[model samples]
Target: MKKANLTKIILSISACVLIGFLSSFATRSSVDTWFLTLKKPFFNPPSWLFAPIWTILYILMGYSFSIIWNNKGQSRKSKEIIKNAMMLFGIQLALNAIWSILFFGLCNPFLALIEILLLWLMIFETIKAFKKVDVYASKLLIPYLVWVSFATILNGSIWFLNS
Candidate 1:
């Protein structure tokens, strides 16, 4: 790979890892305290599973984004498409962090459920947009979408059970 592309990949991955790291601040404190008190569903995975899973997901997300970012279109329309795809990626990324804040930091699963629905939509739209730019990039986000889908169900269940 060219130095430029490698740099973009590293930066993209670092940015995603950084976001995950920062988001953990909200989660770390509550996981042992507030989250433990909640009524989780039987299917809820062990608490220790989250960190590694999230780290992997974030890495995938960043690599996928780097694919889109490095895509240099030859036409005006292609450039526009890439721009919009990147914008969607950014929006969904922000929503990802916001969900963490709402659910863990504020200790509001109900609100988090609502925000996660939007987050899911953004991820879906982002996938669609990424597909237009790079099919592989879009494919890379599939696991993230699936995981968030499961998380949405989990969040709703927790809210229903606890409320």
Candidate 2:
């Protein structure tokens, strides 16, 4: 791929992630207020940890997309496959952002738990689809999946304890 095109891919990937993150900015300041009000599980990690974990996971996801896009095996068939996989990836990403909106933006931990459940399932399917196209793509999603699984459990615990 041309340098410019590569830059576009990187930038595009960055934009998508940033938008997802930025969408929650309005709620971030209120996060503590809402979170502190809730009854949390004893195992909940410090809030400081999530950003780093998500940053690494997002970078991995970007690299995974780059690998698929740059693959020589990407013919019409592969193109369709990659595109579909990327779409699913995008959907799960958007679903992730929705959890932030529901949890922090709307301050609804109960609804957020349900949203994270769907996001977790979608991420699982995304990993499977990604595996079919590129093993690296699937591998790249491991941390994302792991972190989300943790979050899902945390979300449930928070909701249950607080309610």
Candidate 3:
């Protein structure tokens, strides 16, 4: 790849990692104190699994977004479509971070459940939009969507058990 393209990819990954890092602050503060005390569902994965899973997911998200960003749409309408798709991606990314703040920072799993539903929808919309520009990019997001689907269930269960 060209130097400029490589730079863009690096930046995109950095953006995703930065978001994850910031969100983790909220999580780290609570994991040992608040989170460990909660009554998690039977299906809840072991505590050790979350960090690595999220790390991989975030990397995938970054690569998927970079694919969309680097797509060469020729027409004005196509460019507009790409812009809209990217905007959706941004919204979902924000929601992802907000979830950690809501659940861990504020210690509110109920509110986090509601926010996660919105995040799931936004991710779905992002996938659809990405497919219009680049099928591969859209495919790349499927794991993220699936993971979020599972997480939504996990969040709901946590709320149900705790509340």
lDDT score, candidate 2, position 100: 81
Candidate 3 on 17-132: residue-level lDDT in tens? 89999999999889999999999988999889988988888888888888888876799999999899999999999999999999999999999999999999999999999999
TM-score of each: 0.96, 0.87, 0.96
Report the lDDT tens digits of candidate 1 across residue range 31-122: 88999999999999998898999999999999999998998889999999989999999999999998989999999999999999999999
Per-residue lDDT for 42 in model 1?
98
Best by TM-score: 1
RMSD values for the candidates in order, in angstroms, are: 1.8, 2.8, 2.0
Give a tens-digit lDDT track for model 2, residues 1-163. 2112576569646865685578668458567686777778889998788777777777777767666565545489877887888788889888877888888888888898889999999999988988887887688788889989998999898888877
Instruction: Provide the overall lDDT of each model, using Cα atoms, as 2-decimal numbers.
Output: 0.92, 0.78, 0.91
lDDT, model 1, position 20: 87
- Candidate with more favorable, higher TM-score: 2 or 3: 3
Ordered by lDDT, highest first, the candidates read 1, 3, 2
Better of 1 and 2 by lDDT: 1
